[model samples]
Target: MKYTSLFTVLLVLMTACGWSQNDKQNTKMNKLTDFEEYVILNKGTERPNTGLYNNHFEGGTYVCRKCEAPLYNSEDKFESHCGWPSFDDEINGAVKRKTDADGRRTEILCANCDAHLGHVFIGERLTAKNTRHCVNSVSMKFVPSLNGKEQKVVLAGGDFKGLQFFLAQIPGIVRTKAGFVGTGSEKPTYESVQSGEGNYVMAVEILYAPEKIAFDDVIRIFMEVHDPTTPNQQGTDMGSQYRSVIYYNTEAQKETAQEVIQELEAKDVKVTTTLEELPSFVEAAENYQDYYFRSAEGPKNHSYTKRF
Candidate 1:
C-alpha cells in the first residue's frame, strides 16, 4: 500500500510539471489582439471581403500570426475569390488538418503551435495541386520577401534637403543619405552635378528592409514629400539636378516603382516620376548630410514645403 501511494504521488508531480512547462512555452509568443484571439484561438471565421489579406497578392511568405512561423508562400496562392486568402499549397509539414467538430469539414491548424488557421479542401481543381488551404487573414501575417534581399533606392526629385529627413523617419527604412547618382561620373561633387557635369540630380539613397517595408510605401512617401508631377523641379528648385527620378537597385524595385506610378496615374494623379536602374552613388558633402536636423532653426522651418 505504501509503495502504491508513493508511485501515485510521483505521477501527479510529473504531470503537473509537464503542464507548467507546456503553458510557459505557449505564452512565449507575442500577445494577440482580442480579435486575433477570437479567430485564432477560438476558431472563429472572418466575414468575406473584410480580411486584410483577402485581395493581397504580394510576393512573400505568410506566417502564423501567433508564432510568426512560415505557413504559406505567395506562389501557392490563387484567386479563389472566396473572400479569404486561399493557397493551393502550404509549406511541407507546416500545417495540420483534422476532422472538425461538425464532422463535415476538415479544420486546418498551424503545425508548429496548433493555432487555428481555417480549413483545407481537396478535389477543388483550382490549381494543379487541386487543394486549397482556405485561411483567415487575421490568423496570419503577410511577410513581403523582396526575394530575401535588402537594397537602396536612389530617388531624385529636386532638393532632397527636407524630403530626405521625412523619408528617414518612415518605418523599416534602414537609413537615408543625401547623395548624387546617375551623373555618369564615379564621384560627382555637389558643385559638379549642379553645373551639369553629368545627368546630375539631388537624390537620396534610402536603404530599407524589404520584409518590413513595401517598395510601394517608399514610393508613396516619395510622392508625398515632393511634386512628382512637376518636371525637373520641386517648388522653386529647378533644373535637371532637381528632376523627379527613381534609381532602383534591382529589377524588382524598378518594376514596383513603375507599378506604383501606374497606380497613381489610375487615380488621376499625374506622376512624372522617372524609373531607372540605380547608378553609382556619391554621398553629398558633410554639410549636406542631416541638413534639417542639425540646423539651428530645427525641422519645422525647412526647405521642403511638405513634411511627413
Candidate 2:
C-alpha cells in the first residue's frame, strides 16, 4: 500500500509538470517587427491609410501578432474610409474592450494576449452593425481563406472620391480603389488622364464578396449614390473623363447593368450612364487614392460633391 500511494503521487506530479510545460510553449509570443511592437506594446497608432490592412479586404482571419490569437473575421471588416482597418465585429471572446483614464475612446485589445489594437467607436452609422474597431494593421497578422475568391466591378461616377465615399458605407464591400479606366493608352496615369490626354474616366473599382452581396445590388447602389442622369458631370468636376460609365467584365455584368438602367429609365429618370467592356484599370496616384478615407475631416455621411 505504501508503494502504491507513492506511485500514484509521482504520476500526478509528472502529468502536472508536463501540462505546465505544454501551456508555456503554447503561449509563446511570436517575434514582432519594430513597428508591430510599437503598436501592440506601446499602444501606438499607425498613420491613417498606412496600415496594410486599412485598404485590405481579403477572406481571412486576423490573429494577434504577439500570440497568434484569433481577433477578427475578414467578413466583419468594412471600408470606414477612416484610414484604418475597421471591423464591425470581432470573434466572440477574442476581443475585450477596456476603458482608460481618457474615457473618450474605448480601447480594444486581444483578449488572449491582451495586445493593444486601436480604438472602438459607436454610432458611426458607417455600417448597420453600428460598431467600428479601428485597428492598426501591424498588431495583427492575416490568415487568408483557403477557398476565397475575390471579385470586382468598376464604375465611373464623376469624381471617384465622392463615389468611393458613398460606396464605402455599404456592408459587404471589401475594398474600394480610385482609378482611371476606359483609356486606350498603354499607360494611363492620374495626371495624364486628368489632363484629358487619355480621356480616361475617373472610376472607382469595388471589390466585394459574392456570397455576402449580389452584383445587381452593387449596380443599383451605384445608380442611387450618384446622379446617373448627368452626363460626364459628377458634382462640379466636368469633362469627358468624368462621364458616368460602367466597365463590365462579363456578359452577366453587362446584362445586370442594362437591367438597372432600364429600371431607372422606367421611373422617368433619363439615364446617361454608359456601359462598356472592362478596360485597363490604372490606380490613381497614391495621394489621390482614398482621398476622403485617408482623413476624418471630410464629409462623413455623404459625398463632398453633394453641394455642387
Candidate 3:
C-alpha cells in the first residue's frame, strides 16, 4: 500500500513538470506571430522608430502579439517621435482602450483577448490628421510579403516623351511627356549670352504637349536626377550656370511647383530650384540644334548615357 502511494506522488510530480514545459512553449509560440516573429524567431532587425523611414511598404495590417487579432493597416502607419510602431488610427472594433496600471494614462490592448499591447495618445501633431498610437515592436507582427522590398531611384530627362523610343533602351528610365504650356515655347532660349563662359551648357527643353504628362511626374524626375540637397547648382557647373529651374504656365502649375519644392525641403534637401513663371520663350538658333547627336561622333565625342 505504501509503495502504491509513492508511485502516485511520483506520477503527479512528473505530469506537473511536463505541463509546465508545454505551457511555456505555447506562450513563446503566441508571441512569435507577424513582424514580431521576424524580429524574434528569424533574428530580423526592426528599423529604429517603428521603421517609419522605410515608407515603401504598401499592403497588410499589423496584428497583436498575444492573439493574432488585426490592429493597424499599412496606410495608418506614419512617423512618430516615439521609438516604436505608431498608427495614426486603428481598425474599428479591433482594439480596446483602458486606463493603464500606473493610473497616469490610457493603454491599448487586444480587443478579443485583452492582451496588453501599448499606449495610445491623443492630440499629437505629427501629421495633418491628429492622433497617434505608440506600440511596442514586440507586441505586433506584419503580414508576409505585403511590404515593398524593391527599391528604385528614377532619373528622367525633361523632354523624355518626344524621345521615348530612343530613351527606352536606357535602363531604369520610363519615357513620359511633360509640357511647358501657355505663351512659352518648349525650347531653350540663350540668355545672359555668355559664349565661352559657363561650364558645359546642359540646355534641356521639354518637347511633348501638356496633355501627356502629369505635373507630379515632372517634379519626381527632376528631384531624382539632380541633387536637390545642394543649393542653386548641379554637378561641376557652378554659379547660376547649372541652376535648376521650373518654367510654369498657369497659377496651378506655379502652386504645384512650390509644393514640390516644400516637400523636397522637408526631406532635408537644401534646394535652390528657381521657379520662372514666364510669358514666353524663344527657341535656340538652328546651328546649335541637335547638338548632342553631332557631338556623339566627333571632336566633342562625348556620349550621354542613361543611368537607371
Candidate 4:
C-alpha cells in the first residue's frame, strides 16, 4: 500500500465537499453541492465570520472551485475582520466585478467560469490600495504553491517609505525589504548614502512571484504609486537617490521592464524610470526597515501619506 501526500488528500476532501449527486458530466467544472451551489452557482452570501479562509493564513493560491482558475494568492489575503477572506487585490484579469441585484454593492465573480465568489468594495482604506475583494470560502479551493517563483526587483521612485507600504500590501509579493543598490560599492549605510558618502540611491528589494502576480502588474502599481515622470524627485523630496529606477535581477525581468516602459511611452506617459541590472543590495539601517508601519505619528502624517 502507498500513502498519498497531505495536499493530495486535502484536494480530494475539498472536491468531495462540493461534489454534487447528479448532472456532473454536463459541465466543465466540478458539480457543486447544495451549500456550495448556493454561494458559488447562485449569488448568495455566507454568514459573517464563518468563512474557512477568513482567518486561515497559509502559502497557496486560492482557485475557483467551479473551473479551478487561479484567482487570489495567500499573500493577498488580509485580516479585514469582515468575517470573510479579504484581499486587497486579485490576479490580473482573474476576477470580474458587476453591480449587485440591489445596484449598490459590486458583486465579484470568477472571470474564467463566471462562478459567484462574492463582492468587492472600494474606498475601504483597509490597505494601501484602498480596495477589498470579499470572498466566500466555499466558492474556492487553496492549492499550495509548492514551488512558487521568487524574484527580486529594485524600486526607487522617490520616498521608499511610501513604496514599501504599497508593495507590502500587494498580493504575490514577499517580504518588502529596504536596501540600497547601484552605488558601485559593496555595502552602503543609511547615513553614508544620505550624506552622499557613497552616491547610493534609496531603494527597496521587492520579492514577488511572477506567476501569481504578473511583472506588468507590479510595474503598473509602481508607476501609479509614485511620480515616475519626475526626474530624481518625489513630491518635496528631491535628489538623485529618489530617482525612479527598476533594477532587474534577470534578463527576462529586464526584457519585461523594457516592454512595459515602451507600452507606457506609446501612451504618451513620459516615464523617467531607469532600467538597470540588479546590483549589490545593501540592507538599510534597522531604523528604516519598516518606517511607514512603525511611524510613531502614524503613517498618515508621513511625507508620502498623500500618495496612498
Candidate 5:
C-alpha cells in the first residue's frame, strides 16, 4: 500500500509540471502574436481597431515592418476615428487597393508587396474625399525619419545631348523663338576646375554654345537644360542642390536675362527664370565635379538641337 501511494504521487507531479510548461508556451505565443510582428513574420492580415486608433494624433511615417517599405507619410495622415491610421492620400505610389474576398469591400495592400494590410472605406466624413484606409498597427512600424530634418539630394549627370533630352522629358521646359536673342551655335564648351588635392584637374561643364552665343543665349541654354519652372527645384533632385540660377560675372549678364524675359513675354511665353549675379563660379565637390562625361553610358540615347 505504501509503494502504490508513492507511485501515484510521482505520476501526479509529472502531469502538473507538463501542464505548467504548456501554459507557459501558450502565454509566449499570445504575446508574440501581436499585429506588427505578425505582419513582419507571417505577412498576415490585420483589422483596423476603429476605436483605439481612429483619432490617433501622432505625427510619424508608417512603414511596413516586414520589408521596411515606406507606406504613408505623416503630412497626409489624418484622424478618422475609424479604428485605424487614416490617410487621405498615400505617398505618391506606395499603397495599392484591390477587391476584397467579401466582394463588397476593397482591400489595401502594401505597394512593395501584395501583403494584405487592411480595408479602405469610402463615404466617411473624416477626410476631403470621405475615404479612409483602416490599417492595423501590427502591420506597420512608425519611423520618425520620414519627418526629420534629413533632406535628400540626387546628383545626376549626362552629356549635353542627354541634358537636353532630360529637360525635354519634363513638361515645363520648352523651345521658344521669342526668347531667342541671337543666332546660337551648337559647339561644345569645356570648363576645368582644380581638384581638392590640386594634384589632378577635373573637366566640368561640357556645354553646347554657339560661336557668337550672346549673354541671352547662355541664359536660355541654362533654363532649357534644366527645369526653371519649379522655384528652387528640379526633376528628381530637390532642395537647393538642383536650383536653377544663372552664375553671372558682369552687370551685362543680368541685363541680358531681364531682356530675355521681356522678349519671352512679347512672344506670349511666360518666363519664370531666375537670374543671379555671381562673383565667381566655384568648383563643385569631386563627386558632383564632372557628372556628364563621367556618366556617358547613362541616358545617352537622347538628341539635342540648337534651334527652337
Candidate 6:
C-alpha cells in the first residue's frame, strides 16, 4: 500500500495502453493473474525460496513480468540463500526504491510500470557491493541470454537525443547511443553533424535482442515516433543530420524497411525514410548518450517524443 495506492493504480491504468507516464519510457502492461495482482499491484509477498529464480542462475535478463521492462541481469544475480532472487544491482534506472508501508524496509518497483518487485536490504555485507535486491520470481520474466545472439540497428530521425530517448525504452534493447555514420568525415562533432557534415546523417546505434523483439518491429516503431515523411528534417530541426533513415545491416533488414515504407504508402503516408548499408559508425560525445533520461526537463524536442 505504500506505493500501490488507488490513485496510482488508476494513473498506471490510464497509461497502460501507451507510454507517457509524464513522458518517460513506455511498455505495454500485460494482464495479470489473481496472484500476480496480489503480489505486484496489491504488494503481497511470495513465500521465500518458493519462487522460481531463487536458486536459478541462468545467463540472461530478468524483466518485469507485468510490463516486460529489463530489470536485473543474470550476472548480477547471486545466491544469498535468503529464499528469493538476490541481486547486487538493478539495471541503470530500471528500478525505483521507496519506503515500505510499515516504515521499516525499503521496497523496489519497476520504474517503467511501478509494479512491485520486492524489498532491498543494505549493509548486510552479503556481497562486496553490500546490497541485496530481494525480488519475487513471479514479478520477473527471464529472458534467455542473448550474448552471442546480439543484433544491432542504426537509425536517424531528427534529434539524436530524441530518437535514442524513445528507442532505449523498448523491451530487450541492450544499448543506444548517438553517433555519426556515413558522413565520410574523419572526425565529426555535434557542430559538424549539425551542419550535415559531408551528408553523413546523425544517427543512434541500437543493440538489441531479436529473439525478444523482432528487427521489423523496431523499424515500425521508429517510423511511428518520428516523421518519416519529412525529408532532412524533424520537428524544428533541419539539416541532413536530422533526416530519417535506417542503416540496415543485412538484406533482410533493408527489405523490412522497404516493407514498412510500402505499408505507409498504402495508408497514403508518403514516407521519405531511406535505407542504406551501415558502413561504419562513430560514437558521439558521452553526454549525448541517454540525454533525455538524465534531465528532468529533457531536450528541446521532448514534446515530439510523447507522440508514441
The Cα error of candidate 4 at residue 169, in Å, is: 0.7
Candidate 2 regions exceeding 4 Å error are 1-146, 184-186, 299-308
lDDT of 6 by residue, 1-308 (tens): 01111010000011132333324654466666567778899898887745545665646788887787899988898889888889999999999999999999999999988899999999999899999999987687666644778788999888888777666655555556688887563688777778766757788888767776678777777776678888978889988788888999989989988987787789888889888899889888744555543333345652332212
Question: Tens digits of per-residue lDDT for model 4 on 1-308?
Answer: 01111110111012322333323233346655566677787787777754445565658788887777789987888888788888999999999989999989999999877889999999989999899999987687767554646777888776666667556555566456677876564477766666556677888787767675688767776766677788977777777887889988888888887887888788788889999887677777645654543332223312221211
lDDT (Cα) of model 2: 0.70
Give candidate 5's whole-model lDDT.
0.41
lDDT per residue (tens digit) for residues 1-308 in model 5: 00110000000000011111232123111122233345434544444341222333334566654344678776777766555667777766778888876789998887664555677888877777687877765555444422232211111222223343333222111111000011113211222111112111111121211222344554454444444455534444333333345544457656866776676567565544555543222223322221221222334323333222
Q: Can you give the TM-score per candidate against the true fold?
A: 0.48, 0.57, 0.33, 0.52, 0.33, 0.56
Count of backbone clashes, every candidate in sequence? 1, 2, 3, 1, 7, 2
What does candidate 1's lDDT look like per residue over 156-211, in tens digits? 88776666766655556555678787657357777777676777677888767767
What is the descending TM-score order? 2, 6, 4, 1, 5, 3
Off by over 4 Å in 4: 1-148, 184-187, 296-308
Q: Worst ten-residue run, lDDT, model 6?
A: 4-13
Deviation (Å) of 291 in candidate 2: 2.3
Error of 1 at 33 (Å): 46
User: TM-score of predicted model 5?
Assistant: 0.33
Residue 226 error, candidate 5, Å: 60
- In the predicted model 1, the residue pairs found to clash are 158-242
Task: Please write out the lDDT profile of model 2 over residues 31-77, one tens digit for every residue.
Answer: 55556667788888877765556666657788876777789998999
